[model samples]
Target chain A: MNQADSSTIVVKRTIAATVDELFDAWLDPDSLAQWMHPGTTALSTASVDARVGGAFEVLMHYPDKPLRHHGVYRQIERNRKLSFTWISDATQHSETLVTVEFNVASAGTEIVLTHERLPGQVACAEHTQGWTLAFELLADLAAKPLVLVTFDWVPEMPRGFVRDIRVRWALEEAGLPYRVQSVPFSDRNADHFSHQPFGQVPWLTDGDLSIFETGAILLHLGERSEALLPAGPRGRAETLEWLFAALNSVEMASLPWSLLQFSGNNDGTPGWNMMDSFLKKSRLAHLEPLLAKREWLAGPFSIADIVMADVLRLVDRFDGLADYPACRAYVARATARPAFLKAHADQMAHFAAAD
Target chain B: MNQADSSTIVVKRTIAATVDELFDAWLDPDSLAQWMHPGTTALSTASVDARVGGAFEVLMHYPDKPLRHHGVYRQIERNRKLSFTWISDATQHSETLVTVEFNVASAGTEIVLTHERLPGQVACAEHTQGWTLAFELLADLAAKPLVLVTFDWVPEMPRGFVRDIRVRWALEEAGLPYRVQSVPFSDRNADHFSHQPFGQVPWLTDGDLSIFETGAILLHLGERSEALLPAGPRGRAETLEWLFAALNSVEMASLPWSLLQFSGNNDGTPGWNMMDSFLKKSRLAHLEPLLAKREWLAGPFSIADIVMADVLRLVDRFDGLADYPACRAYVARATARPAFLKAHADQMAHFAAAD
Candidate 1:
């Protein structure tokens, strides 16, 4: 369509997020599902084609009806701009042009969204409200880069087994950018306790909010990005529940058993042997039946898998998960992810740098 | 304030919740905190006076400042009506009468909230908007009565140890009413698997939403009521983290160790003995120092405490918690709550009813 024949409407919003992060939200299918829809409508299905001339489709689900929007990417400029042709069943128009420009602002990223080739004024007005609400949601999420805090170094045995790996894996999986800060493991200061009351590592700082507990940090991040979770309430709830199950149920057993193995107490006493058997019969065995039924704990790869895999990997180190083939395979499948590999390498390098 | 002299504004809503459940939401401190505030604002504190002439106070906290509202309960009728006086610094009037009437509706509960004795037109309009939003929040929550599904009976050992206790405790803590249904323990049919994929008891159904996993159920309930959780983001996050810690961490070890003890396999196998020792040395011992520093796990009484206490209590029965004096005291303190008492009694009676 010629510029003279088409009409254009622009909506601008300043978000409290980095240019790259905010820009990535547009191209990432998971992130788009989280904030693209209006009101309480959830994205039932979202698929992305990030390159020029590639096509993308997203199905927005409401209680009564589902609205599917599909478009072809006409222009792609990472962290700067994105332009595409949009068509939806709800709209009378066969095709419309939508362009999003991301500019670095004092606070964060300023997003300028322009919708061109509108059929009429009514469609423009309706889309204006929809885009306004969508940006508001994005702005709220892009408000900050979550800060992950951890230790500079730890004991040799637990070197790769640090709690910070969970946080790193979580951030990497979500495709969220974060900076890591370190504290002394042996000599924890009052400030450390202020952030993490237990004087533990892997607390998080998101803007003015300081949150302790690795599970809590993961949950906070999960709330913002759909990569670690899902937009549907039931899916989100399942992810959360499974995440807890991994940490509280499986890890609870594995941690102690691994500690015994690390401390040279493996099969040393009756107690040590009993603990090993319990880990095998109670935690891992129970998990086998559950894992056998599905590849992922919550049906989709989520934070639950990340935490569960991390914990179970420790058990596998001691060969405790041998009988539970499904559990072992589940852990292997999760660690095979590029995100997990990067997180593992980065964690090892972090401690190596301090050395 | 007499009805003749006062100006009353009635905000009516048809919620999708049972009359008893909806009515109890007002008297329940936890339930009130979830839906009482406007928009994203959270309750800092909510204390209930569920009797006639008793006083109550609720502090709604914003990021910048806090708004405190306190008044006397003029009347209370269970599953019928609740009337109280509303006062805040923002208001010119010292007191305003607020009455909420709950009636059974075709969809759910029809709630008519009457706010009387407005100072001016502006105040009237603002309060109207605030109450309207608050009711919308309630309607969203009350639209579903969470269902707790469990087995009719189990082994003598796992009788009181059923997972349903966690749900019952959470519901009681939040002052939310729920109905209990049973399945045959010997044969968990396909219908049971539909609700609980794991074929376990204690799945929850709210409206059309059915969720399994005890941790997930508790978290779901926490979203609706502040009693099982806290109103503030930090508190709620902490509660969630700790709840996971209790279930995944503490319960993971405790369940196995307790099962070994109950089966009289305490020293029967080397694995059982080792698990018992690990439970003592790692899980329970690590919890002691933390409990020594605080009365509750997450600062305030929450589902975290209930789940943790329940898990630790099992440890106590096996004499594993003897060394952890503080953990014992913490469990004692949690079980002492009236809600916990009622929940425990109800759970016991539920099994008894089948017998």
Candidate 2:
């Protein structure tokens, strides 16, 4: 067995709409507004350019706040393949890529999303957990039957990264039933790579559909559930903006900061110095203002909180996050959820068994 | 000015809608579906999670082929900031980050987007040009009066990259007026960083808005005019997916292939050998399939083709791309556009001035 063999979480659900209708929900601005948010604010004014080499952008607004988010379409294939580049309104130079695939299945539209080329392994793990939870939420919103497959590896299973907790919390919040498919790291193999293109664990397969990357899975799940996202235009937009902030803005900064523990040899190498500088200027500096403004990053207890809490947990592992009181408090709120408890317990049990 | 300073390109445009309204268009999935794809198809579904710690995803579908794109939100600041990660369903492992900011302006929203933390300098240059053209497309979609601001630097003047052709084409396509501000590279003052985040040329500003990266610029421009995108759900989705394939999938592969020229040095290193393997495995493998199926990358002549053509042009620069008849045909189709001709002529004129 190898690291990829160990599985930690599983989800199953049935959607209310047909495969084509459910798939169409992704393209239609109105349908998107209907089920995009779990329980926060609703989406307002959805717009898109659905074409080859066409530009697509969306703005989501919160009624009481001034927050918003924008995205551009990188690629689009009707009901089959979609990809784009994403960035936040807050920073100038940080960008990430996301892709989702929808395959028609006997059961329904089998959706598989793969988010790749992350900065490093740590990011991969963090996103793996976050995406798992979000997908659960999506299943709930779509009222569709779905399944999620994930694993927990030994020796390097970042215990501090609490993204699993978020997934668990979303499931609990939605009052959904799920199962676990724990695979020991010793059992991982090439087959796992077939499921996860990168060979990393924490992948999900819904019937014939399979998805890798935590962020993409989370989105798939979130779109299905009403408990994970809000129901109105303003609320939904607010929720969406926070989602971007958590994955792109906060997570981007935290990845490098958390990696310091593994790479910090205290040597005078240029790479170390560069990493250190990035930690100071890029990660820490931006986080300060972000945490100071809100109790939950956005409004209510959305997936944004889940992703941020997980990222913060990793930062806390190295004692780097002690300075941010808001972040610490936010982490506490997210972990308090019952689903988070279940997810964490499952991870611990799986890790113990592997040991 | 030196050769580096001679080839700089500047682009700009204006968009209607208030700063908040325009900003909301980004966060709201519904609004995104509207102007997002100006000339292509209508958006089928648009979803968002606009919160700090939330996870957001948008999937755009095509009208004809089996292509779909999904994006995840990473950051958010009410009405002021947003960011997210981008990935492709095809590659599934490569991820990139993008960010945008909305400033409250008396006239309208001054949106500034920054796409950063790319793999390296080569990727950075290509992204800058691609983003610029995208922003130009955005401006056209928005249908607001706008202007273009550009700067000339001695070292970074004509920022030589393939995507510049796309930016020039977008400007001509929209028939938008633009101006340039020349800066000598010798003057590495703080102001340079303010105009061009990386201190490179091809930076742009419209009214209170300032942006860097050709892709972002094209999106901004496309938002102004509806002509850049298709008109229906499937058409718009196809356009967006093709855009992503051009930038993330196709361009990514082409970049490494082109870099081989720089690596074949007299230093007696194995750079050429590494480059050869890279081209044969990565670039050729992907291009073969992409060219076999589509006449244009996505459909018709969208921004995706513009960017793809520019990137593929490099293939001819090093070795002839004639082997790929489909790719050659696509290039011819793209170049045949009147807008492309003007952009090419403008670029040539700029180069001619350098002599």
Candidate 3:
């Protein structure tokens, strides 16, 4: 069975988590069961013997049948690498070699998976396809604990106004389950600043990756599902483009204007109001034409639409979107989604519970 | 020769350009010469007979050897699709069918290329590798004419303060050649408003894609080269995070404060100056510890560094970064790159020539 020209497939992915978390997940029965199976395949069982020379087994319950996969651990380098010999029902004696290496990347861990020594052409091709799907699931599982941080309570004026709602809306749209953690509104301590540099609420943590910006957190979630982002490159690029546009261009103008109104400074300064009005109006005017033709910002209701809608909703709240009918409708359409309704309801309930 | 199970390799990329422009580039000899070959492989000659049933030839001059690729046009549908039969020295008699289809993507055109009918396994493997490289090149060529738009002149106070410098610096860092187009500073014409709704300088156009916002433009350039943005996913994600951090988080705070200083409104308002100072100082203080440990924002000299450095440089100019020594040093290190020096010099020259 020594096919000298046997093919080897290598797949690499960078997950926004530490090496320890990712490496441990490979050996943890629960984590392995969650991600080892391909799309829509249920894991019947995952038995892990994590040490060298130990055995492990996983059973995938497909719609038609169940497939048993067994392996013997050959090497285990904690937080660094692992290698094993794979044995399956179809290729019980062939014994494929699979090696996974974890390298510390800039912000996370890069996992390099090499599957070697498949018996024949068809098996090689099928294994390659399986690994691709499995790796994507692994990437999703490795970046875990998508936590949304907010305040325990806020005044009625700023109740729904907290930034965590944007994140909740995104998670609901993507159908990803998450937990909400709260800090006391009265005291902003060192722990708050450690997670969020600005000591602001709505910072997110997926595994070890803690990001402060709501825009960044939305993008991190967008990577997992096409419901929040499109699968194609064109849609993904445009989504990122408009995502930045909402944050930097639209929100940058709307935020200060909204702040001035809240602080009762809209009519206080000599030229601040005029500058604020001109800036907001000019940005809205630029957006009118695009919204007139397209239903969503990046065609198929992507995170771009989510972000742009969220930014404009604030404007809509302040009655600032009256001049732009298309943008107003866009926001209306986005908010009318069932996911948005649930997210808004959940957010309201969470804050109301505190009261 | 009729290998029924012959392999077909398909590659698709969405270029941020119109279909008409991308189609013309495929036929234009000059454009074909620029992107027909893979990286560092020079195009020796490109002779075109673009009409259907006509033949065309291209010579690729690699350092060690020369290769000639000949093809005959089978069908052409101006901006939608094209098909040809490819004949090379290796497969002169066993010609391959190559089809390219263009579809309107969300923000641009998506090109799908299929290379079909390889005679053998080795040929199939070789062709797949070739097509992948060629497709990457085609994507770069398809998105052409990266233009940076700025004002013809600005007052001495905002001379170097122009936002276009950020785009220019990014382009230089990516080693991308770009053209600068200027609008009249005195009149902010309708054309200016159309391109930049805020009548701001420093929007960019790549082929048919015209995008405003310096942050957006830098990201567009970052897509072209890993020199500006890391090719790895982790670094890229972190780069985007920090890029937004510079814009939505840091610049959002700094720009208004700097503008107030430029307009000599620093001492005018009793509470405005206090709010401005508190906002700027708070943001800066948050940034200090991060800069202290890392040489670059995201652990590499990426577009994130370029952005954070540029934003902090402005703060330093206004004497606002006095408390943040690490940020100051980081900016100095980034500006010290030859690419930054060239971009700064070119931007100054472009404006000075207008004067």
Candidate with maximal TM-score? 3
lDDT tens digits, residue span B112-177, model 1? 888888776667778878888888877766643666778866766666768788888888788786
lDDT of 1 at B252: 65
Query: TM-score for all predictions?
Result: 0.56, 0.40, 0.58
The C-alpha RMSD of each candidate to the native structure, in angstroms, is: 21.0, 25.5, 22.7
Clash pairs detected, candidate 3: none
Candidate ranking (TM-score, best to worst): 3, 1, 2
Q: Which stretches of candidate 3 lie over 4 Å from their true place?
A: A1-145, A289-293, A322-326, B1-145, B182-199, B207-209, B268-271
Error of 1 at A221 (Å): 1.0
Q: What lDDT does each candidate get?
A: 0.76, 0.53, 0.76
Candidate 2, position B335, lDDT: 77
TM-score: the better of candidates 1 and 2: 1
Better of 1 and 3 by TM-score: 3
As a whole number from 0 to 100, the lDDT of residue A223 in candidate 2 is: 59
Model 2: runs farther than 4 Å from truth? A1-144, A160-166, A182-190, A266-270, B1-355
- lDDT of each residue in A96-200, candidate 3, tens digit only: 899999999997988888878777777777787887888787777655477677886788887666788888888988878555666878899998877777777
